[model samples]
Target chain A: MKILLLAAPCLLALAVPLYNSDSPRLFGFPFFYWALIGLVPVSALFIYAVFKMDGGK
Target chain B: MIAHLNWTATLVFVAFFALVTGLGFIAGRWRAGDLDDLAEWGLGGRRFGAWVSWFLIGGDLYTAYTVIAVPAVVYAVGAYGMFAIPYTILIYPLLYLTFPRLWAVTRAKGYITAADYVDGRYGNRWLALAVALTGILATMPYIALQLVGMEKVISALGFEGGPWASHLPLTIAFIILAIYTYQSGLRAPAMIAFVKDIMIYIFVIAAVIVVPLKLGGYGAVFDAAGAALAKKAALSGKPAGLTLLPAQIMPFITLAIGSAMALFMYPHSMTGILAANSGTAIRKNAYMLPAYSLVLGFIAIMGYMALAAGIEVKNPQDVVPQLFLKMFPSWFAGFAFAGIAIGALVPAAVMSIGAANTFTRNVWKPFVDPGIGSKEEADLAKLMSLIVKVGALIVILVMPTTFALDLQLLGGVWMIQVFPAVVFGLFTRWFSGWALLAGWAIGMVVGTGLAAGPLAWTPVHAVFGLGFSAYNGLIAFVLNVAVAGALSALLPNTAPDATRAADYEDEALA
Candidate 1:
């Protein structure tokens, strides 16, 4: 379960087919641009979840 | 040789530099610990809580070169330079999984360097020494790149003089850094990192918002950058624009993943991890550190803004600094330049301390004096820190800045080779010391040759005739793991393992 959560971000970010484009702009950022920048928060959330599950406190 | 020397910027830079120097000196007493011990001096007493660790590691990782160079590349190329984005983002997950275990084991063993952990895990002094040597070799060039970052900011501020005049400020800055780091090892960088991080956040956030609005808006900035790349592509007969080409996808993914793997392998990063107060602190910082990457994403756009502003610099690395000079008022520009200059200092201090600790603990203690006391070890580390700083200064002064930058790239290629030994060894001792050593040797030789030869220096292209070039480090890493796995199964264990599996698992509770 932990490994699956950890691997999700890497898979989504690096898969190439999912985000390699200039269309589908969000807030004027191309899909490629916004997707890469957007992943920062998403990856952080996954890491935070893993930390919480690990009893990080 | 001063082109557009703005007194306001120079004064602001000087004032902030003076303030940080004062903080550097006073850092000796901050958090007051046993100054004579390596743990106390070299690792900041190994007691950094989440907040301090956050700022320290943030300041250490998002360096002056990163701030200057990332935008520079983005401005010069296109989406390719944003490789730093995914690399920084992915690093947290990897760290989340690895650093807590590393911190637990190192803290339990009282090991100050990764090589110390290697020695304990495998009971082989030679394998440990290999890790130590790789750490020092990789770190020196990284330290040189920080000096190069300082030099670029200095030159951009119109201080390009006869070699002596231009380098004088950098020399003085490094000398002050060497002294304070000598006096108070890791504490100096940790304390000054607060001032540096604040300055960076203020200026970088300001640049992202102010620079785009000055040149109309984000749409205009992208259009301008796209037009510039299209023009260049026509002349060079290569595809270029605001988007990545189909061929670039593989290289981009491999570069990001390869670099993420290599980031924590560097000795300075490991130093930051080990300095945290607890395993929980290490884990918490992993989640928090990505905030800097968000800031970096904003900073990356400043490169696109530079294009829209049409700022011209001979060296692409100078584009962001030149962009600041063009876009902002004199006083604010000075603040930006000062931010870059101070950004260089924090990482240099941390890196020198990391390299010095690797030398003192791994090399001197084991080889020079097997029974070296804590006080003497601290003294040796202090001296080595000064030597490493001076050595980097000499390299920066004598060599072209591009050479240092290339060496910095090569440092990553060299460092990733150690991942099999250090990161892999943390999980399982399935590989013997001899196999790990052999893998490391082959990886270093082949990785250096591939990265430094055609890929870096020569006109010839294509890495390993793969038709599409990828990050040389990743290629070498795959080979390193393959050789180690094969050799581990084929060969007998030459040295009996001193550390048991329970030692690694027990770190979870540490």
Candidate 2:
């Protein structure tokens, strides 16, 4: 479960830059407007899952 | 050539600087219990989580130097500059294995600085003293080079002064940085890193997507770069001439691998690692952080693309920013320049903080007074941190740009000397402290001699007759390891396995 959780953020990081052809705009800006838009939320979720297993930083 | 003064870009750059400076000052209070200890000031209360640590460490690692210079090399050297790509990629898996272990042990041992680890692990003040001196020495000029990167960006922004105009803003920038850093401590840089990273990602991604389109296609751009460098080599009289490839393939790999090994060992990287909250966070970052390198690879290619499109980067370091000016709309270019300009600031702050820690703890406490209070250490660290910034600014004004960059080459050669006593010391207790110091001293003398000698072709020149150059640091590392290993067998001494490693080796597997 812990290892599976770790793989999740990598999946999201891979997905955002590849699939968003419709220019998935953030805050009414261009698709490229927010670089970390996808990076942050996904990494956060993976970190949260890891925390449950190990307790915390 | 400095006349491309786009006020819009200048305005955006200054506005962002103001925003970054404000964050630095307030960060002194972040996660505050009390500002009474050096650890809190120097390492952000030593409790940074995944998020802050990610930005802080990333910001420290990926500087304006790499952002602009790597691409500039790609612009000039073809596949040669791509060395940065592989080096950055390979370094992560390496750091992931080593860094987490280092972080775990260091934290467990209550080691704030790498020298602190050297001191505790070997129980040899002389060995620890050699390591600490190397940290302070290596970091001073590395910090100076940060200001040099910012100045190149500033000059490309079209700012001009008298004969001295080139470095005046850099001096002012340091003064401003020093004040806020003194007020806030390491938290200042950590907090400011949020803004800096956002700006860099926007600029780098925008360049990767937008600029290539502006120049036609990636294929066409590479063809142009090839023609340009071939033309340059024709004039220079050397085959690998026009591009940064000066010598050949062997060197391309050496510079990359040598640099990668030395990267984490640099005091700045150690400082970045020390700021993380836990070993787990550092491990998590190890894989995730390679994402920055992905941006870096694309960023490096922009240099070749810019040269192909007839954009002349005034300073090679300003090549990426200048490319944005050539390709983008005025407003967008201003935004992009802000990213490069502000990007320089984050690393400068971190480098100054790292240098300050060396001066305060390694230089001051262990030598000046054997038993200083934590509050006094913190206070002195802040004071010295300011002085370190000032010292770097002086170097900024006086150094030739080429000389400033060469310092990194020397910095690499010098810092890697400490690996035996710091990194290897943890895994084994066999290497005697005296042997380690002897190895370190020899590496510095030989490396500095080769690097500083009069060899016209070499990056760091050479000492008198011995031919050495940019990659001399790697040579020094070899000599250091061999000497240390040989001497250890000759004189067996104490300093077996570390206390932190003992406690955690079982915890990790259990």
Give the winner by TM-score: 1
User: What does candidate 2's lDDT look like per residue over B322-369, in tens digits?
Assistant: 787778776777677667666777777777777778777777888889
Give model 1's TM-score for chain A to 2 decimal places. Answer: 0.93
Q: Going through the candidates in order, state the TM-score of chain A alone for each one.
A: 0.93, 0.54
| TM-score of every candidate | 0.96, 0.85
Model 1: chain B TM-score relative to the native chain B: 0.96
Angstrom error of the Cα, residue B141, model 2: value is 1.6
List iRMS (one decimal) for every candidate. 1.6, 10.6
Residue B467 lDDT, candidate 1, scale 0-100: 73
